[model samples]
Target: MTTHHRTRWLALPAALLLALLPASASAYPNPGRVTGDITVHDPTMLRAADGTYLLYSTHGGLEARTSTDRIAFSRSGNAFNSPPSWWKTYSSGNDPWAPDISYRGGKYLMYYAVSSFGSSTSAIGFATSSSGKAGTWTDYGIVHSTTGSSNYNAIDPNLFVDDDGKWWLSFGSWWSGLKMIRLDPATGKSYAGDKTVYGIASRPTGTKAVEGPSVVKRNGYYYLFASYDTCCAGTSSTYKIKVGRATSPTGPYYDKNGVAMMNNGGSPVLESHGRYIGPGGQSIMSDTDGDLLVYHYYDGQAGGTAKLGVNLLSWSGGWPTAY
Candidate 1:
């Protein structure tokens, strides 16, 4: 494994070492150290075949950043030189948010959402790039969307390709929480035969703030990691990363304590600690050493600036614990 991909526990202080003990509501660890051009929101990162880390996030035409060591990042420009014309329909400012990037079938596919704040008339857009870098993306148009009449808002999309060769896209925000749909891998769009909109997780009783679903399979279990509560309010943001697990990707997921995720059940993976406030908008990335819990947090020390946060995850006791 590369030096950047190794477990970094040895460098952490005693207080931060408490993160490895168990999942606790109030004992979350501070974000691991990162520097240079780290200001981001709803960030997603993937290491390219050439071992360069490409990080993408909300706004600025889905802003791009690059890192060779995964510790020091440099601004690399936007994924698109010009926003797609269709973006204006959902977001008047043509702002795209929460980009999910993955490498599949010899190409890089990006799934992103375009919508104004708190609007249900949202659309999830698709694009492809051979290089997974700025200026190479070709917008493929909408894969899924919603209107004010719909019960769920379509945004914060994540594409998960199951081990059995099934492609699934999980997305949604506010309105009615997270939803999933089957995708056609051939065209990178919704699958025609399966018109099912799977309900994965939600808060039925209070605060329907769950969004940003990142699904990955480990040890024969499908784990769903999502952001819970409010996001984007700077220091006052209540966002925190939570998780659940199920036997299937389209799941009736349960938290660590056997609470159903569809009814607001989620085990806390990371939350506010010290200078890190509202740590959420997360994506899980697999590295050589282990799975990484990659997300953005409002930096209280920096006057509530959104900054990139990265931490290694340990799946001990069948639940993810971030340190």
Candidate 2:
């Protein structure tokens, strides 16, 4: 969640900016107008029924922020004033990571990961809030996890509910790539009947850096989006967002070219170009304007500082294009 490295870089020259820009001109879309406490990582956002925009991201006790018109954001304390005591069972520091939040069953549900850096001994924990406010969440303990003996690292939890009312949780990082398991709609835990952990995406041969899985259903197809390559290196980071699709939530997802995602097939949704060095760790949210692609990018113009980057997504071609 929180990276240790500090990035420092000079701004791009005007001449080089034109050359580095995407060829189509429209290919390079600027992040939506936002200001005030925009520093964040792995951000997931939702508009409350009262029209308040709540944004939660990775940090100490899962940092929180709020927006009134979706443009300007301000710090609103953290989800927890102190780390949950049970967190020590999984994370050595008792600090949690990427938090996936959604309004489900008329209440706010958040699933997050707790683990040490580069360690497979990780766990995905759950929490709920009646009012989705800071210091109001109740920890529900671990939903799922993997020990050092397991091949897959359990982190970056994402909850997806299908139209038929089936709940699926997709999560993973490194080791064996992205994974999803069926969950009980009521408890938000693994479904009792189906004990299947489906493999959706992987980079088997080279760097197994693909992670941060988020699933969104658009036009009858379930699209799987994930972050690929090295992250947390600031401007030196190579993280980029990629996508694949399938009819079923538990997928043998394929890219635009019909290549299976399990074999490293993914179409680039967003990448480092121009001044947006390493744009990734993305989550999709349906806003009043349209679908918003929210993520953290190392700002090349600001010494590679991690900043919030949000762009509206256009899916006219049956594939997502960020603008």
Candidate 3:
């Protein structure tokens, strides 16, 4: 929630930020238009099993794109298309950043990012695809790593299975802001103990361009959601989209003015308009005609490139509003 209006330099070229974002974010649609031609970053969603609706993103690598109507997408490739072979040993060939998908043993896993970004040596890899089909990945290697320490650079990863089923995995950035533990539910790969439990810290200048962390749980509470500033750097990006809330599942959360995004403070659920530069890497899915807000923004309509938006969120009085 800090915008005194100063960051600008957008020369508008990537096809005009893709024709002023589907002709100005497609004004009013009962809430349902997000189309422009797939650019995705940090953004992630999955429903498959023939229902179709798979979007996943990340920068410098990872990428996966698709859409059933969340607004026209297509590029379903490079879920690390072909980078292993010891990937330049520590970071040059398989930088494959951000990739998160779920659906256990019956297979679909995903959860990627091998990293070198701000280096802690980085790693959080895993891949499987029982015909979830996106060129059929199958790595399943470093299911979680950390070589030295940026305190926790390991890379933005997210996974879930709560409500008592356990299986957790949130990640961190900026030395330590978001962190979680307990994982292992049937080999989601390691950790059921070194106990980090959960922690949040949205940047009180400890210098965390925040970092994408996503979670969900509606009515019973537990929201999380992070993206705070500076991502992908396409239009001098200074990202946005922040949130908090917690009824447990590791958090002191809070936010809609009750403050406490670990106290660094946060509130606005989404920001940036007119050109949508640096929106965020968020996630949300609910259905039955409810919440949507899947993310990735920065298209003054594709000239600033980096597409995919999909709003249609609501909760109004309890927060989480998007349109």
Q: RMSD in angstroms, all models?
A: 3.3, 6.5, 17.8
| lDDT by residue (tens digit), candidate 2, 35-120 | 89999989999999999999999987999999887878999989988888878978777788899999987899999999888999
How well is each residue in 1-323 modelled by candidate 1, as lDDT tens digits? 23443446567787877766566545776677788999999999999999999999999999999999888999999999999999999999999999999999999999999999988999999999999999799999999999989999899999999998999999989777899999999999999999999999988997888999999998899999999988999999999999999999999899988999999899999988878999999999998777889999998989999999998888898889987
lDDT of 3: 0.70
Query: Cα lDDT for residue 134, model 3?
Result: 68
Model 3, span 5-100: residue lDDT tens: 112314557676676666546332222345544666777777687777777777545667676745566777766567766545558756677677
Better of 1 and 3 by lDDT: 1
Worst 10 residues of 2 by lDDT: 1-10
TM of each candidate vs. truth: 0.93, 0.92, 0.31
* TM-score of candidate 3 versus the correct structure, residues matched by position: 0.31
C-alpha lDDT of candidate 1 relative to the true structure: 0.92
> Best TM-score goes to which candidate?
1
Model 3 misplaced regions, further than 4 Å: 1-63, 66-69, 72-75, 84-95, 99-112, 115-120, 123-146, 157-175, 178-292, 295-309, 313-320
